[model samples]
Target: MPPGDAYDAVIVGGGHNGLVAAAYLARAGRSVLVLERRDQVGGAAVSSRPFPGVDVRLSRYSYLVSLLPPVIVRDLGLRLTLAKRAVSSYTPVVRAGRPTGLLVHRAEPERTRASFARLTGSDREYAAWRRFYGMTGRLARRVFPTLTEPLPTRAALRAEVADGAAWEALVERPLGEAIEAAFADDLVRGVVLTDALIGTFTHAHDPALRQNRCFLYHVIGGGTGDWDVPVGGMGALTDALALAARQAGAYLATGRTATAIATDGSSAEVTYRDAVGEHTAGARQVLVNASPDRLAELLGEPVPRPAAEGAQLKVNMVLRRLPRLRDPAADPREAFAGTFHVAEGYRELDLAHRQAAAGRCPKAPPSEIYCHSLTDPTILGSEAAGQGLHTLTLFGLHTPARLFAADHDAVKAELLSATLARLDAHLAEPIADCLAVDAEGRPCVEAKSPVDLERELWLPGGSIFHGDLVFPWAEEEPGESGPERWGVATGHPNVLLCGAGAVRGGGVSGVAGHNAAMAALGR
Candidate 1:
């Protein structure tokens, strides 16, 4: 506690990965310190009471989390309750000359196929549709492990390639091409294609693009579906992580912003400026939670260059009401559980990315929406006496928030309006009345929701993922510099990267931080 006192390690961010790294290191008998810029932690996986008596997620950015390893949660003793289904998506189908709309729950493949057959009956190939999913799940389970850590060595890579023949087959084939080759039914193709587009930066039928397949890797990890909510809120995950770190004797400080990292060839020190004064902490090792590029700014031209440009943008809305489906049964508290997807087919999805890429919002922007209140009643259950409230998070692709040319208030209002307008187009009633409050309720909303916030918040390129997963970049060779390779470890001796930008991409996966600790500990 003395001035300039040294610890074994200093973790830069309080996001889950940073906290997890602290817990692992502290438990290993190493002295660790965690510094967070915000008063509270959790990063994107945080929850808050923004509106009066209504608990809403600040970003609620990520809905389902299957890719999170059980070992980390179990080791941390995190009490995570999987929602009924990971996620459920709905696409409205208009019957020709019927003047009626059918909302299809696209999460359940068989049920979706049946529903699709109702419209494209003669063309649905149920068998091939089943085969595609089965094969995809198998392939994802195989390839997913490779992404968790630095790229495997040559021998490891060869073994993985041998073990991943199924994934290779799926990856080699374009999703639409695979569907056409595998199934005779157009409806089956549409459903599979739609699933491929959710949360991805790619078009639905874009051949050779595997972002959806990468997305599937996360979805399958969910165990049952595409999304899951903690018993209380996403913040619970952060709470659990902090609890783990605290239990292990790590020191945590909020409102401590890291300004620069100085390495004297053998050790690293974090320099910070705070309300009281500027200070420095000496440590044998340092772990940074900001993205690789941002870390470069702090450290000045380290290994990894500007990290992978982030591909997607997210918006979180605390809705007054759950989204109304064109039909009521869309609420499959049972059939298909957690998350919801908005866009429908390959062509429609293609147009979305086209607009986003062109710096314009898509006319019918595709969103993956999650209404946590429906699954985890705890959020609403506690405030029964207060106001009826629900929170919905929509993840979409856009030109960065800073690019909006509007001020924060105007941009926030426009985003809220745009999201609500899209929801109204898909549902029955206008959601304006359901609004108990908006993003303005949470101060971090601007920080977490906008890409510009990333740079301002100290994450390079607003990337939550440390880097892109493009090949060769992901290939790990000794002395390589990319995040997919070196990760949180600074080729610079004792320095380490811990946050989402460190490596293994983002999304609450602690691999980069965890591995960096292990490497620093030389375990």
Candidate 2:
């Protein structure tokens, strides 16, 4: 902890990515130090018992894991366990003034087909759904393995897929155009497009095709892109990473904020602040696991900011029991076990995006909910489960950061009220009625806006991806070598970016961290 201590590598921002990098570097026999500003090291992936007198530990910010690679899991020997949901999604759609549900079962294709038939009155849409996901599944298999290796050129990537038509439909065309052409029903189309829009605010047909990049990452994760729940909540994963890093001889210092980073000809320096005083550390190389904007600020340089804006409202609630669905035939346990879409049909999502872009909240906010407790009851323990307690995590789309820039508190309240009302539309009773009260008798609900995310997690503009997602592979160039092909390299010789802001970065995937370590190792 001395001011002039030197290490082989120094990592700023001890989020999961930073920890991953630290673990890998330390395991390679390099002296590593990780400095985290927060009291805890998890960043957004931490789990906490927010409600008083409640024994529930909720995955506060980032809930599901779809991107953490198995290679990283095996490399670190992490003890984290991920549980898959039996139901992929259960969206409630109103038919003839009576609510009906569209259940996408992971294990039972026939059941999913039946649900689609009942809702759309046809099996054609279900067949299309299979074909579309099948294409993504193939792409996932071809692409996911290459992530840990050096980046490939776009042409090389396409050649690997070997399916020109499928690539053109998914990678070249606008995702919105493809979705519309593939499905006839609005409900099914919305469900497919939702993957593209999560934490991203963009139209399906955006010529820039930002949504396409987002969608690609969503489905290509884990080779099949199934979002699994952490058995002990997200904290368990972070804790395991931290443990791995520490056991590998990496020095992790919490409550220490890196204020500035400067590089000389051969080495780098990191100036940080702690409770007692300021200190400076030296390293042969520096790995930045922070947002690009934050990195620029630390380096005292100006860089064109990415078109990054977080457009979602996150609300975490511990309910006494699952809310009853309006559909009489649907079981609340089954429906809430997977993602529950609320007012998120194709037309509704498009309208919400248009309204938000025009600087107005949609009349009916579109959102998706998940019951984490249903998948992993261990989060609540026997005391809470005996009382029939559950957790409902709702993510409201089209609630952009700009909307809350002027009056953050007031706008957040208004957005939360509207979002809950939208969810209540499909429920037989108000969601508030199933609330679990704290010792103070307050409702067990906590809502976070983009501003809150920016303030707490240092996510620039509250963008969960750190920036607009870019195509994973490198663009073709005349001459590029190993380090040049990697996305983690900064302009500085000894400085690297290992955060979500890097290309092929986002989600809970530690690919950036892995890439950064390999770059530093001259691989």
Candidate 3:
């Protein structure tokens, strides 16, 4: 806790990735310290009781886990539990003026097959769906393991994948070609495309291929492409990492704002401010667990590149009961268990993107909804659980930060209302009816626009992935530096990026931090 102290390594932020780096470095017998600007660690990967006096702790920012490698969890002895949802997703649609839905079961193939047959009137689309994911599944198993190790070159990864057809379809060409060729149904195609557009604002055929990178990251998680719920909300995962780091003798300080970092390639000095005043800490290396833009500022240099403007709306709500679905055959519990697609038909998605890109909120905003409480009710306290309370999270896509620049508050309110209306269209009962009041007797609902995220969480453009994601592999032959091969390299040898902006970094995964620590130890 002493000012002007020196350590072997100093981390600039105490997010999950920073905590991971601290745990690994300290356990390796390196003197380590983590400085966090926030009072509590975890950054956006945190849980909160947003409602006044509420006992429920919603994973307020990052909701699910998919990209975290099993190796890091084992290496750190993380006390975390990730629960898989039985139903993968349910997309409700209106056909011939009759309401229906398509359900994808996580484990039961027959049920899923039957559901697909019922919706499409044939087994063709279902078979195509399997074959499509089959390609991704093969690639996922081949690629995910290399995340924490030295970054493989593009040629090395492609040669290892060995499936030219898959590599060409998923990696070489735009994702739209695969989506169009694999599925006939519009809604089904849209469901498949959702994975590619979660936090990134791009169409399937984006020439830059940002969507492909997003799709690659989404499907390569855990090698099964399954997005699992963090038991007790996201806070549980970060808390475990914090505990592991502390147990390994890493010093973590909150409310420590790192103002500057100066490194001469072998050693570094970090200047930061706390309540009292500015202080300096010297270290052999500095691992920055913040956006590249933020890191560039601290180093008195121009940003490497702009972090993409995060383009989506995050809404959190507490409901007394699950809202009834319009479809008679679909169970509300099952429908809400996994991702519930809304206003997300293939055409709808494209249309929404066009609307947003043209500088307007979509009249029918595309969004996805899921009830976290259905999979893990432990996030709710005894009173709320006994009272049948549930938490619903809605992620509104194609709602870019640009829309809020004119009038932030007004635009956010309008988008929230439009998004809710879009949800109500698929429900037999209005979502408002199922709302629960917090201790203050106000509706237990809150919404965050891209601007809000930028203000509150410091997300560049409110982009959840921090910026447009780069490929997991190195673009060219890596430099001689150890961190370059690990995808955490910076211009300075003694400084590395260990946050979402790092190559192969994003989501709730600790891969960046682990890679940075490995890079530091090796360097």
Task: Give per-residue CA lDDT, model 2, range 1-523, as digits (tens).
Answer: 6334899999998999999999999999999989999999988889999999999999999999998989999999999999999989999888889889899999798999999999988899999999999989999999999888888889999999998977887889899888988999998999999998999999899988888998999999889989999998999999999999999999999999999999983698999999999998999999999988898889999954554688889999999988888899789898888899988899999999999999988888899999999999989968998999999999988888999978999999998999999888889999999999998999999999988999999898899988788988888741353345678867787888999988788888888988898888877
Candidate 1 structure quality by residue, lDDT tens digits, 1-523: 3234688888888887888888889989999888888888766667766555444544354554655766777777776665554334444444554312222344556565665456555434544555666666554555555544555654465465464544454454555556567765433355556555443356545564655444454544533324455677777777888888998999988888888998975788898766787789889888887776667777877557534444444655555545455554455343223444455444556676687677666666555556666667676545542555666666655334433544645554565556557666656566565555543553223213445545445544555455543331233465543332545555466777676644454566666667676666665
Best candidate, lDDT: 3
TM-score of each: 0.83, 0.98, 0.99
Q: On a 0 to 100 scale, what is the lDDT of residue 478 in model 3? A: 95
lDDT computed for candidate 2: 0.90
**Model 3 Cα lDDT, one tens digit per residue, 59-145:** 998999999999999999999999999999999999999999999998798989999999999999999999999999999999999
The lowest-lDDT stretch of 10 consecutive residues in candidate 1 is: 97-106
User: Could you tell which candidate, 1 or 3, scores higher by TM-score?
Assistant: 3
Clashing pairs in 3: 310-461, 310-462, 310-463
